[model samples]
Target chain A: MASKEKVAIIGSGLIGQSWAMIFVSAGYRVQMYDNQPEKVITAIKSIVDQLNNLESKKLLRGNLSASEQAALISGATTMSEVLQDVFWVQECVFEDVALKQKVFKHIDSMLKCDPILCSSTSFIPPSQFMGHIRHRSSALVNHPVNPPYFAPLTELVPSPWTKPEIVSRAKAILTEVGQKPIVVKKEVPGFIINRIQDAIFAEAYRLIEDDVVSVEDLDAVMSEGLGMRYAFTGPWETAHLNANGMTEYFEKYAQGIFDVQSTFKPVKKMEGPTAEKIIEAMNKKVPMETLNERRKWRDEMMIKLSQIKKSSQ
Target chain B: MASKEKVAIIGSGLIGQSWAMIFVSAGYRVQMYDNQPEKVITAIKSIVDQLNNLESKKLLRGNLSASEQAALISGATTMSEVLQDVFWVQECVFEDVALKQKVFKHIDSMLKCDPILCSSTSFIPPSQFMGHIRHRSSALVNHPVNPPYFAPLTELVPSPWTKPEIVSRAKAILTEVGQKPIVVKKEVPGFIINRIQDAIFAEAYRLIEDDVVSVEDLDAVMSEGLGMRYAFTGPWETAHLNANGMTEYFEKYAQGIFDVQSTFKPVKKMEGPTAEKIIEAMNKKVPMETLNERRKWRDEMMIKLSQIKKSSQ
Candidate 1:
C-alpha cells in the first residue's frame, strides 16, 4: 500500500532463507514459495528469528524492534501464486541443471507477463534456466551471500537477453534496500564472489600442500595483512592506494605479479602430513564437538559487526 | 617500574611507531630506538600525536590518555641504549636484505642479555639474517602489519635453527601487546598473506586482461561479495562453518578445488588494452589529483575499523 516492492523467493533453503531475510530487511513484501509448504514456513520463521537475534544484539540498524520487524513477512503456496502479484521472483532451488530446466519450464508457462524473474543459482549458467523460458528477456541471476541478515553483497548477473530496463529497475530496488549490488555484465560459473573465492582457495590449498605455511598461518595473512586491507578495499583499490596510484603500482610491479603467478602450480587433492596438520589445528582451535557452538559464536559476531556498521552509519 | 614487560623497538619509522602504539596500548613501556637522534625526536612526537588521534576516534584501547601517553615513549639514540634491560627487541628498518644483515649483526652483537630479538621485515626470511649471529637461536621474524596500532595481526616466523623458547617468548610478548600473531613453522617468500593476495591479484589481473570484467566490477566482487563474508570469518573457518564440519567439507570438495586449481594458468603481466581500461576505471573512481586526500580517507577508515574491533572485543 505504501508503494513497497514485491519479491517472490523460490526454494526456501539456507540461501533462500537468507534472501527472505534480505528482502524483508530491505523493506520488500516477500513471498517465499517452496513445493513443500513447511519449508516456506520454516524459512520465514527462521528469517524472523534471525531478525530478532539481530535486534537482541543491538545489531539491526535504525532502532527497529522484533515486534516492529515482524510486519515484512508475506507468504505463498505456489509458483503461480508467487508470480501472481510479484515484480520480481528470485529462484534459489538446487543447482541441478535438469531440475532447473524442469522448474523453469513450469515457471515459463506461468509467466504471462514480464516481472524480472531471476535465478539465485551460484554455480549454474543462466543460459541453462533462461534459454528455454518464453520470457527469457526478463530472467537473470541475482546471487546473494549467505545469512544475508549480516552480509550485504548481492551479485546482479544478467543473461545476454535480459533487458537493460529490467536491470535498472532491479538495481534501483536493491539500492532502495540496504544491500550493495554489483551488476555482472556476463554470466560465468561461480559468478564473481565464488570465482574469486575459488581462485584464492586453490593457491591457499597449494601453499599448504607445498608446506609453505600452516592453515592458521594462511588465515593470519588474510586476517592481519591482506584481510585487514581487503575488508576495507578490494585488490585493485589496494594496489591503487598502496603507492603513487594503482597505475603506478601496476607499472612498477606488473612484472613481479607475472613471475609470482607463473610459479603457481595447480594443487593436487589434499594429502600427506598437511591435511592431517590442518585437521589437527582445526580440531584444536574449533573442535567438531563444538562446531554448532562455534557457528553460533560466528553468527553472533556477524550480528554485532553488522550492528556496528549500521549504527556507525 | 611496575611488573609489566619491557620491549624495545629499534628504528623509528612508520613500522616502529606502529609497534610503539601497540606496545603502549597493550600496557607495556615501549623503548623506541633510532640510529638518528632527530628521527627519535620526530618519532616520539609523531607517535604521541597519533595516540591523541586514536583517543579522538575512541580507537585507542590502552589505559593512557594523550598526555600521559608521552610518558611511555622512551626514544633512544641507539639500538643498544633502548635494548638495555628489555625483554625483547622488534627491529623495523630498511627492507634490503643487506641492510637487514648489517643491522641484525649489530643487534646480535648488542645481545641485550639474551632478550628475544625479532625483525619486522615483510619479505626477507629470518634464517638469512639470523644464521651468522652469535645470538642466532634467540632471533626470528616478528613481522607486524603496517600500522599495527590499528591492525593487530603479527606474523611470528622462526628459522629452522631457531630455539623454541625464543619463539614462545616472542609469541607471548606479541600476545601481551594485543597482537593476533600466527606462527609460521616454515618460511616462504611473501609468506602467507602476500602469497594468497598475490594469487587472487593475479587472477583478477587476468580477468581484466581477458576482457571479462572491468576494474570496478572486479573490485565490487570483493567489496560487496565474499569480502563482506570475509569481514566476519576467515577462509578455513568459513569452510568449517559452511558444511557440517571442516574435515567433511574438505574431504568432499578438495577434489573440486584440485580440479579448479588445474584450470588456473599463471597470468601474464598487465600491458596493452587492459592497462588502459584499468587506468580509465581508476581515474574515474579516484582522480589522481586528490591522492593525498584519499590517503587521509584510507587512514581514517582504518582507524575506525580498528576502533570497531576494539569496541566489539
Candidate 2:
C-alpha cells in the first residue's frame, strides 16, 4: 500500500539521501532532486552504497532488500518534476534562512496538491520560512538527527500557521518509515533535543572552566556512567528508579537538587580560553585530522547498539 | 599480583555487594560485613547469583569464572574481622550524615595500617564524615553508579585532607577491577555524575512543566536521538563532529547556544504539580508496582550495551 505513495526529497545532501532511503525502505516511490543534477547523481550513488551497507549489517528498516529499496528511488531532472505527484516533500537544503525561504517559496508555487511540506532543519523552526509559502498550512520542521538510520528520532515542530492534521500526517508518515517522531507543540529555538543538549553542554563547559574535572574525565563520567542508563532510559525514568518513585525522589532530593542547580554557573559563550582548552583535549582523543575515522567508529557502535536494542526488546 | 590483596566492603547492601563483585572479579579477596550478619549472608548469595548471571552473559570481568569469583567473596560477622589485613575498605552505609560519621570513626579507629577508607556515598562529600577520622589522609569518596558491574564508571573524589597517594591507589584499584575511574580533583556535592545528571534533570523538569513537550516525547528525543551518539561519544566529541571541529563548532553556534541557554527558566523546586505530572506520565509507561520490571529491563539493556561497546571496538 505504501508503494503506491510518492514522496520527493529536495537538495540531495546527506539528509536528503537518508530520507530517500527511509521512504524507499517503507516502499514509497522517492523522487530525488537537486538544483545541480550532478549532486543528485552523487546522492543516488551514496544512497545505494548506504542501503547495501545497511543490508549487510541487517539494520535495514523494512522487509525490502537493499536493491529493492534502491529500485524505488529515482533522480528528478527538475524541481517541478520532483513535486509532480508527491504526497509529501522533504526539503534538505542549506541551513541558511534566506536560502530555505527562497527554495520553499519556489516549491510552494510549484506544489499542486497539499502534501506535507517538511524541512530537515535541525535548528531552524518552520515559522522562519513558511510565512510566505502558499501551502503554509502544510509546512513544518521534520528534523532528523545525523545517521538517521541508527538514530531514528524525528522532531515534528509545526509553524503557527500549520494545520493540526498536517502535523499528524507528518508524524504518521515518519512513524511508518520506522522513525520515532516527537511532537514539539510550539515552535522553540533548538526544539527539544538541542535544548537538552545545550543544557548538558552548559554544565560540561562549567565543569571544565572551573577545573572540577578534566575533559577526559568529564566525558568518561557520561560515556561510562550516565550514558549507560540513557542508552536504555531517559532522565525522568532514571529519576523514578533512583529513588522509590518520582514522588519519593522529589520528597528526598528536591531541596538538594534546587541547591545544586542554584550553584550552576551562568552560560558563557562557547568561545574564549575555555572553548580552546576543551578543543585541545578533544583533539587528543579524536584528533581533528582523524574525525572521519572516529565518526565511522561511532556509527559502527550505533549500529551495534541499534541491534542490541532490537534484540533486548 | 592483585590476587594477593584483600579488601573489606562494609554494609552489604546492593552497592557493597556490587563492590565486592568488582573486587573479586579482579582476583582480590573480598570480606563482606554488615550490621546484621543475615544481610551479609544474603549479600553473599546475591553476589553469587549476579556473578553467575554475568558469566552467562559473558560479561563477567577479569579472568575469573563465576564460581571462581564467588569463591573470592566471603561474609564476615565482625567489622574488625572484615578489616583485618585488608589493603582497602569501601564503606557503604546509609546516607545519613551522622551514621556515616560514626561508621567512619569506627572504621578509622579499627584500621591496622592505612587502608584507603573509600566511601560509596553518592551525594555526601567525604569531608562531611572524614574530618575526625584518625586515618583521614586515606579517606575519600569512590562513588560508583548502581549496578557497578556493567556501568563501570567510578568517581574518585578526594577530601581536602585525603592524601594524593590515596587517590592514585584508589584509582588504580578501581582500574584493576575493570572499572573506568575518573578523578574529581576537588570535593563537590553530588560529585561529577550526579551534578551532570541534575543539570539534565533541571532542564527536563522545566521542559515538562512549561509544556514544551510531553514526558514520553521528551524521553524519545534522548533515547532515540542524542543518546544514540552519547552511547559512543560524549558532548565534546559530539560538538566536534556537529561542525568542522570543536573550534569551528564554537565559532558557528556558540552565540546561538548562549542565547538559548539564557532563555532557560530559573531552577525551581522539583515538587508540587511538575513532580506529580512527571510521576503520572512515568507510571503510565513503568507503573510503580512494576518498578522492578523496569529496572530489570534497564539492566538487561546495559548488559547488551556493554557487549556492543566491546564488540564495536
Candidate 3:
C-alpha cells in the first residue's frame, strides 16, 4: 500500500497542534514546525496527551486508534524538513498581516512542490499576504474556528489569484479530515464566521450600552434561545422552519424584521463604562482565574455536542 | 394538598399549547381559552400527545408524570371562564396590534382579579396593546422562542406602565418552571431576543446579497462553527473565553471587530432576487413537502442538545 500522504503544520501553537491532530487522525503524517524547537517539542507531547484523553472518553476522531494517530505526528525544528514531501501546508501563525506576508514570502522561496498553502487566519484576507508568493495560485485562507477538532467549520477563502482547483483540493482534504468547509466567494475581512460573530457582538454592545438588558441576560438570549436552534440550523433554515417556508416567513415578518433592524444603534468601540460593566459581570460569572477551567468545560461541551450532532445525522 | 394555582392561556396556537404544557408540567392548573372552541379542544389533545411523546423519550420537562401534566390542562370557550380566579394570564394571541388591544380590553373588563397579564407576541411591545387596558399596570410581554418547550428562553418585556413587582413575580415563576428569562428594561420593537435575531438576519442577508456566501454555507458557519460554543455560552462569555478575558479580547480584536462592523451595509428590506435565490436554495435543502419532517428533526436535535447541556451542568 502507498504510504500515507504528508501535511505540514507551521506555528505549533494551540491551533497548529489541533490541525496536526486532525490530519494525523485521518492517517496523514503531520510534520509540525515552530520557530522555537522547544515549543514544537512541547506541542507534540501535548497533542499526544490530548489524543489519549479523547480516546479514553471515546471522543477521538477518525477510525484510527489514539496510538496510531499519535505516532503519525512528529515535530521538526527546520522549515525545509517540515515542508518536505507534503501535499498541504497549514500556516497557523499570528494574525498580523505583515508577519503573515513575511512568512508566506519565506515559504514561497523554499517550496519545491506546488502544494496547497492555506492560512488559518480568522480575519486577514489571503489577498493581503498571498500577493508576493511564488506559488500564489496554490495559496488561500483556510481559516478554522478555534479548537477546530471539536468545532469543524473551516472557511476556504481564495484570493483573486488563487487557482480554483486549489480551493477544491483544500476543501476535499479538509472534509476528508472531518471538517465542514464553507467557501467564501470573496476575500472579505473577518471572512464569514467572524463577520457573523462581530455582528452579534456589535448588537450585543449596543443592547448593553442602551441599558436594555444586563450582560448575563443578554448572553442568555443566545445560549437559552436562538443558540439552541442555531446549533442545528442556520438563520435562513431557522426562518424557513419557523414559518411555513422561507417565502411565507419573509412575507409575514419582513416588515417587522426590517423595522427592528432599523432600530439598531450605530456600532461603537467596546470601551467605557459599558466595557467596565461587562468585564465586571463576566469576571463575576467566570473569574479570570477560572478562565482556563471554563474553557475546558466549553471544549468538553463542544465535544459532547458534536457527538450528539453525529448521532443525529 | 392545596389546589394548584390557576393560570390562563388565552390562545390555542402552538405558542399557547407550549405555554400550557410548561405551566402544567410545573403543577399549575391551566385553563386554555380561544375564540374558536374547536381549536382549544384540538390543542389540548395535541398537548397531551406531545407530553406522552416527550415522556417516552425521557425528555419531559418537570417531575410530574405525563398523565398528571396532561390532566391539568383543560379547554375554556369563554374569556370569563379562563380568567376567573387565575393568578397569571399568558395572552398568546395573533401578532396584531389592534387584535391584541381588543383582547386585552375585553379581558381587562372581565377580570375580577388582577392577574399578571403577559402577551406572547414576539414582535409587538406591551405598550402597543396595553395602552388602553384598565389592567395596563399588570400587563407585559413574555415572548418565548419557537418550540418553547425545547428551547427554554423567554424575554420578559415590560411596558412603561408595568409594575416592578409584576416583573419580579413573572421572573420567579418562569425560573421555577425551568425556562430561562431575560428582562428588557425598556420597550423596544422585537424586545431582546428578536432584536438580536434580526441583527443576525440582517448580516446574513447582506452576505448572501453580496455573493460572499451561499445560503447553505452561511448556515454551516453557525451550525458547525460559532453555534457550537453559543449553545453553551452567550456572546459576551464567548468573547471572554476566546481571549485571556473580556479586557484582553477587546484589546486584541475590538479594532478588527469595529472595522468589520463599519463595513456592514445598511439594512435593506428582504425582497428582490436575493430572496428568490435563498428561497430556492432552502427549498432544495429542505423541500417544502418535507418541512414537517425537517422540523421534527430539528426539535429532536434540540431535545438531545438540551440533555447534553443539562448533563454538563
Q: Is 1 or 3 the stronger prediction by DockQ? A: 3
- Ordered from best to worst DockQ, the candidate numbers read 3, 2, 1
TM accuracy, model 2: 0.97
Residue-level lDDT of model 1, residues B1-313, one tens digit each, is 3536678888888888888777777667788877788988888888888788768876666676766656777877776788788877888897788988998899887764888888998768888887888888888888776556656777888988799977887777777667878787787776665567778887787677766677887887776556655655677777777777778878876766665556555577777777778877887788888876765565665666556555655
Q: Write the per-residue lDDT of candidate 2 for residues B1-313, one digit (tens) a residue.
A: 3466899999988889889888888789999899999998888998899888878877677787899888888888997899899888999988889999999989877778878889998889788899898898988898998768679899988999989988888888788788999999887767788889889988988988889899998888888888878877788888887677888888888988888898888898888887888889988888889998788778878877887787666
Tens-place lDDT per residue, model 2, A144-189, is 9887867888899999999999888888888888899999988877
lDDT of 3 by residue, A119-229 (tens): 998888788999888899999999888778889999999999999988888888899899999999997878899999989998999989989999999999999999999
Ranking by TM-score: 3, 2, 1
lDDT score of residue B25 within candidate 3: 82
DockQ of each: 0.52, 0.77, 0.86
Better of 1 and 2 by lDDT: 2
Q: Chain B TM per candidate, please?
A: 0.89, 0.96, 0.98
For model 1, the stretches where C-alpha displacement exceeds 4 angstroms are: A1-3, A61-69, A251-257, A270-280, A288-293, A310-313, B1-6, B110-112, B270-276, B288-313
Model 1 residue B125 lDDT score: 85
C-alpha local distance difference test of each model: 0.74, 0.86, 0.91
- Which structure is stronger by TM-score: 1 or 2? 2
Q: What clash pairs does model 1 have?
A: A240-A246
